[model samples]
Target: MAEHGWLFWALTSAVFAALTAIFAKVGLQGIDSDFATFIRTLVIVAALALFLSYSGKWQNPATLSVKNWGFLVLSGLATGASWLAYFKALQLGDASKVAPVDKFSLVLVALMAVIFLKERPSAQEWLGIVFVASGVLLLALRR
Candidate 1:
């Protein structure tokens, strides 16, 4: 378990992400997706702030390097945008369909890592990506 700690965390992330789609879809009813995203972001910030302060880890954030800030800000923006689109899609589509399409980003991430991060995926990883891509396409096709 210690050696595969990351795998455990990744699996936990997938479970929570699946729950997120179901919960968000239900919550989006009678609410604007953008407003819902804003509310969710506020909740996340509050939770993180409370955890950081409780753990006495809330050091001066100003000490972070400019490069760190730049990347973090960009990442936050990307997250917000992704959430917005996901919420909107969930509002308009079935969770079963929307979730697979959204998760197709996993395949995109693998390709982007190879091209931009110069990280080469093993053949098995590539095969898994292909399977995910195929599943996404099948899920997306009109019945």
Candidate 2:
């Protein structure tokens, strides 16, 4: 079960991601994208805080090393940028088209992992990336 944990979480992530696109698209209909992103972020922060507080896993901030803080801060910044862009895209484009294009990040992540993390993906993984790329194009192309 532990070995398949990531697969389970990835599947869960995909489901929630679909819901995110749908909800954000509808919520963004009349609001500024940046403000929408801000509201979403606040809700996420509150939810996580509540979860951590209930779980008793809210660690002391001073326990983190500088390296850990640096990476987490960078990750947070990237997430914020991605959310802002995604919300703006949803505001301007069809959710169906924008979401598939956004998911091209999946292919990019595989490549980036190879380059930056030196992780070797199997041939099957590469094939899956190819299919994902193809699907994105199919979904996003106007003609």
Candidate 3:
């Protein structure tokens, strides 16, 4: 059960992601997307801080190695950029369209994992990635 824990968490993340798009779209009305993203980031930070404290999971930042800090900072920057772009898209486009197009990251991640991480996905996984890429193309191309 513990080995399959990731599957449960991944599904939960998907549900939250779907809700995030819907809620962000509605909240973005009459607001600057960058400002909205900042507000969202603040809420996330506060929530995580509280959760970490309550769960006794808070760790001393100074204990982390340089490599851990560097990669985490890079990941944070990437996440911030992604959220800003996603919020801007949601503000300008239909949520239904913007969300699916944003999910194109799935295909990009798989390809990047193969190239950079040297992780070879099984053929079945590659097939799914190809289908996801095709679907993203279908969503992105002008009809």
Per model, how many backbone clashes are there?
0, 0, 0
Candidate 2, residues 1-143, lDDT tens digits: the string is 99999999999999999999999999998889999999999999999999999999899999999999999999999999999999999999999999999999999999999999999999999999999999999999976
Error of 3 at 30 (Å): 0.4
Higher lDDT: candidate 1 or 2? 2
Candidate 3 ranges beyond 4 A from true positions: none
Kindly indicate the candidate among 1 and 3 with the higher TM-score: 3
Candidate 1 colliding pairs: none
lDDT agreement with native, every candidate: 0.95, 0.96, 0.94
Residue 121, candidate 3: alpha-carbon lDDT: 96
lDDT digits (tens) for residues 1-143 of candidate 3: 99999999999999999999999999999999999999999999999999998999989899999999999999999999999999999999988889889999998999899999999999999999999988888887756
Q: What TM-score quantifies how close candidate 2 is to the native fold? A: 0.96
List CA RMSD, all candidates: 1.1, 0.9, 1.0
The candidate, 1 or 2, that scores higher on TM-score is: 2
